[model samples]
Target: MHDTTHHALQRQRRQVIWGLTLIAFGVAYLLQRDDGDAVVRLWQYWPWVLVAFGVNNMLPPTDGRRFVDGLSQVLFGAWFWITIEGWWGLNFGNSWPLLIIVGGLGMVLQPLAHRYFPRHQEERS
Candidate 1:
């Protein structure tokens, strides 16, 4: 079970890395995003960055490191959301298959990311 959990966690990390890479590839479109830009349109569905933030923060803290990492993730997500909405003028579209694929992937990884986080251990007396 533990091995399974660890494997799942690793898989989640890979998913996150790949998903973000796909999003990053949209940067050119993101930079020039308008109604006609497919890449930017694709990135428009990233509100789940906020959802990931919420999930990442709800983990047990082992020490200051965990807290800092959580804080950073939350901040990064918030910044990403705000910048995309405010600056990028984000909007959703009918890119059903791709949107579903990416969103579902990111969502699936959230729980596994939470699982891999350091856990608070009992104090040795």
Candidate 2:
């Protein structure tokens, strides 16, 4: 039952991943200018974004309680993006949406993980 939902969600994400094509195109334009500020900023925060993305993909199948608890306590992806930007006092501009997108993806993953892989146990009466 749950496996079907999980597979469907993964398929949906695979489709939405196309949106990132625009990111590459935009970056190419920025780098073409070769502005030092643009280049340095790109190098600085890009890794964090990548890390968030990786974590999102690898979120494990676990009890929904653990998943919800962790996500609520720690902000990854877009949440981290906003925190880093705010700490540096940079007005979050275009990248602001990434935070929600990334963070929300984790939320999405949590349910999917739980739906697909709920904690296994003996049936309780």
Leading candidate by TM-score = 2
lDDT of 2 at 108: 76
On the 0 to 100 scale, the lDDT of residue 12 in model 2 is 60
**What tens-digit string does per-residue lDDT give for candidate 2 at 1-125?**
25456556645654554456457647755665667666556544553544434443445532454455445434553345555567655445645665566567766777565675454211110
Please give, for residues 1-125, the per-residue lDDT of candidate 1 as tens digits.
Answer: 25456446645754785677566656756666665666546666575565464444444332233444455555456555655566555333322244455455556655555455434322211
RMSD in angstroms between candidate 1 and the native structure over all alpha carbons: 12.5
Q: What lDDT does each candidate get?
A: 0.51, 0.51
Write out the backbone clash pairs for model 2. 78-99
